[model samples]
Target chain A: MKELIQLIASFVGAIGFSLIFGLHGKQILLAGIGGACTWGVCLLTDFLGCSLPLAIFFAAVFGSFYSECLAKILRVPKTVFLFSVLISLIPGSNLYLAMRYAIEVNRELAMANAIETLTVALAISLGIIVMLVTSQIQARIKSRGNRN
Target chain B: MSLTSVREKDRMADAAGVVRLALDVGEQILLSGGEVGRVEDTVLRICTSYGAVRTDVFAITSLVFVTAVWENGEIVTQSRRIKEVGKCMRRLEELNSLSRRICTERPTLAEAEKAFSEIMKRSESSWVKVLIGSLLAATAYTAFFGGDLKDCLVAPFVAAVIFGSQFLTKKIGGNKFFSQALCSFLATAAASFAVAMHLGSSVDHIMIGCIMILIPGISVTHAVENLIIGDTIAGLISLSEALVIALALAGGFALSQSLFGGLLI
Candidate 1:
């Protein structure tokens, strides 16, 4: 039940961010669905006993792939979908906790939180890079085939 | 001889006009949160489509430089310095479409300028929508982060405070870093006050939710992506700016937390 509620919350969160970013019409709905799927993937991986960073990495991979495909279909820039879909995966909460811990003068806890935050951030970046490189290679191959 | 010179002058003016138009479009894309590569690509496309024999564009996060050569070997070079950046996906989409149209249709300079202004005029989001977006994002994120019902209920009001402060900061033309710090401070203080009054369950959860509204998640992600794609200079600039904003946010929250530590949590 908790997981289901979290999933719905992720959907609402993405829709809200899409509106904030001035996206309208069908784009907003697509962003919300994308955000929900990203979070669901993360939760599923976590449930399967993957580490937190690994879970987040898998979720980001799926999210970026979704954005790339949708951007091609809709004839829009990929950032439009990418920003809203990946909002839920950002390490905002952990960053905040790290700051709070530092302020409270707990060096150990602060360092741990900060490191966790950085690791998760790196995981997300690598995941997105993987998809981006793949897409670029695919485009190059198609162009070369057409040329031949 | 006079007639030939007059035609030459007209051609020179036309070449300059095309370069200017291309630069304007590229600048708009950068200001509307597009990547550096997109700005460069759009500028080059617009210039070539308008009969420029060769075009070169160099774009960073804060500036765009373009030089285009005409058939007669006249070179027109222009640049724009971008001071402000914003996130408006709608504007980015509209500008993308406009550039595509410009490339294919090769519209008159006057016609292209008119279309560009129309898009700018149409993309200003209404205040009601902004308020609702802030409210929903704050509340939903609170719940997503495991906040209870009371904490979620208090988030929208705190979110409103952050939005109002943000609007006022922009209106006064304050520094971007100052604006971010102010918003984070207000959000933290407001959330703590609400929880102190027994309106919310967890200060941590509420603070996290409100802070999400102020995080530079998009910028960080874009910065890393740019680095990976070999836009090293642009990526470095964006990354540093994101770091500064994150520092401001964290500093403001910490200050507020210290101030309210005695009252709660």
Candidate 2:
């Protein structure tokens, strides 16, 4: 039940950003689905007792892959959908906590939160980069075959 | 003048026109927050098809340099210094489609220019729609982040107030740094107010929703993308911008927490 609500909320959040970012027509709805899918993956991984960064990494990978395929199928730039959906996975709260702890002069707690933020950020970005490289390689192989 | 000579002159002029057109499209894409390599590729494709003998494109975060040499030895170059960087997915999509069509349709210089102008002027969403969308998104985040029913209900009200103020700040053209700090402080304070009113169990969730507007996800993602594509300069610029914005956001939240610390959390 909790997972279901989170999915809807993720969809709403994604649609909200998609609209603000000036995504037009049916692309808004598609981006919303991408956002919800990312949340669902994140939730499942968390449920399985995976660490925060690892779960976020897998979730980001899934979201980017989903967005890439949808963009191809819909004939639009993949970033249009990926940008909106990726919001759900961003470590906004963790960033806030790290900064707050630092302001209070609690160096130890601040460092821990800061490290977590860095790890999650790297995991998310690297996950997307991996998907991008794989897709480019696949495209190159197909184009070469056509040339031959 | 001989008719044949005049015709040859027209062909050279046509080549120059196409090179200029390619630069315009590339500048538009770059300023609209596209990755560096994508801008380079689009310009290269357009200029080559228009019969440029040689082409070079160099792009950074705020500037684009494009030069082309025609078969007749006419060299055309453009340097555009972009004034602002904005994220407009609709415009990006439109420009992408325009470049793709230019490749396939092979439009003449005049026709291509006309099409480009029209695409750039694609209509903006009304303010009413933007406000509603933002408000709804805020409410959804409140719920998604584990806020209960009362927080969900109050989230839109706070969002409306925040965006309402944002509209004024945008029109006034204030400095982005101070304005962002102001907005974060205001949003978090409102979340604290909600806790005082017994609206929800969580104050931090509301702040997280409010801070969504300040998150640097786009810049960070684009920076990594540029780096992966071997455009180190553009990537570094984007990373710096992201870092600066993040610093401002954190500063605002920390200050606000000190003021409202005793009230909640």
Candidate 3:
């Protein structure tokens, strides 16, 4: 429970900062939640000894579902919510580390890490595409039922 | 008031009235300027709570030019007629509860586009964007090969110059899509060249960083959204731009590889 509260606080903090930067409070909040959740899941995967690439991908999928659930509860755009969450998964740290490794002439390590980082980025983004696409189809079915 | 005016007032009240609340959330996601999409979502939730159906609420946010219409009501077009409902924190818990009562649906293309452009023009500072882009690219170079700030800075700087040129070119009546695509390609090529010249690292490293700076991943997200909502035309337009950018980057990478074989990765 304390962990959950901290996560919420961290998400709120990020959103608060985002709000200061001009993002809508609600969207930022949702994004913050998404980011925190994604971060948590990724950390969990690390602890579980899962492949970082696969972990990032599945975590992104988890984030999307989380976004969808929140969007349903909050009655907001899921895509907007999910996209912000994905931003947190951008491997910004990995990207940063890759640069440092390259600068140090640790070519082997740098290449390995870069590949890992890029793959993670790719996986997360791909997860977003898949989730949004599937949800689009689901929305269509709902709309059709409404019309009928 | 005249009896006729009273009738008019009744007609106005009965004429599918909408409830709007303008909550000043704060600056957007990137800390540049203007409130992002939170206002619209908040307004929608509030209106829906007060006996207004999701289809009855219409959000008009000035910063993003986003008029989010959840309900198919009488389309009001003015931005000034909107009013603030309450202070952000004052009704936070109530607002959250209210949001739960509202059932949200996908917004229209026009609405999404307006919001996107407004944020782009406001939330993102060009200088910061460039700085972040350069840092991202530099980080890539430093990670994959080996380089100092000098090496890291060079590629992103070249990228910023290219991107700036595109911005200028856009003002001069050139197509924004084409210009951005070209700019990304040039930026990537410049970084690759820097690597080839042994400026600091391998071409792949710089390219990795450069691509981060150049790719419109955020915009693509919006585009995907537009498509999902069945705004095919808008979605296609955004998709086309994204594709052009990808192709341009690939072309640049290929060209550099052909010209400087040592840098290919």
Point to the candidate with the largest DockQ: 1
Tens-digit lDDT track of model 1 for A38-141:
99999999999999999999999999999999999999988888888989999878888888888889999999988887788777888889998999899999
Per-candidate DockQ values are: 0.74, 0.64, 0.09
| Model 3 lDDT per residue over B1-265, tens place | 9975664444335322333222222112112211223444555453343333333222222232223333335343223332211112212323333344332432222343354444344433334533443443334423323334456557556656565765576577565455655665566567666655667465544555445445554445545555654555545665676556645544544444455544443
Query: Which pairs, if any, clash in model 1?
Result: none
Q: What 10-residue stretch in candidate 3 chain B is worst by lDDT?
A: B25-34
Once model 2 is optimally superposed onto the true structure by TM-score, how far is the C-alpha of residue A30 displaced, in angstroms?
Answer: 1.2
Better-scoring candidate (lDDT), 2 or 3 = 2
DockQ of 2: 0.64
lDDT of 2 at B162: 72
lDDT of 2 by residue, B1-265 (tens): 9975675456578776787788889888876667778888889989887777799988887888889888888888887887667767888888888899988876777888998989887644467767777887888887877778887877887687678767877888878777667777777777777787787556677766766666776677678777877889988988888888888777777777788867565
Q: List the residue pairs that clash in candidate 2.
A: none
What's the CA error at residue A43 for candidate 1, in Å? Answer: 1.2
Scored by lDDT, the top model is 1
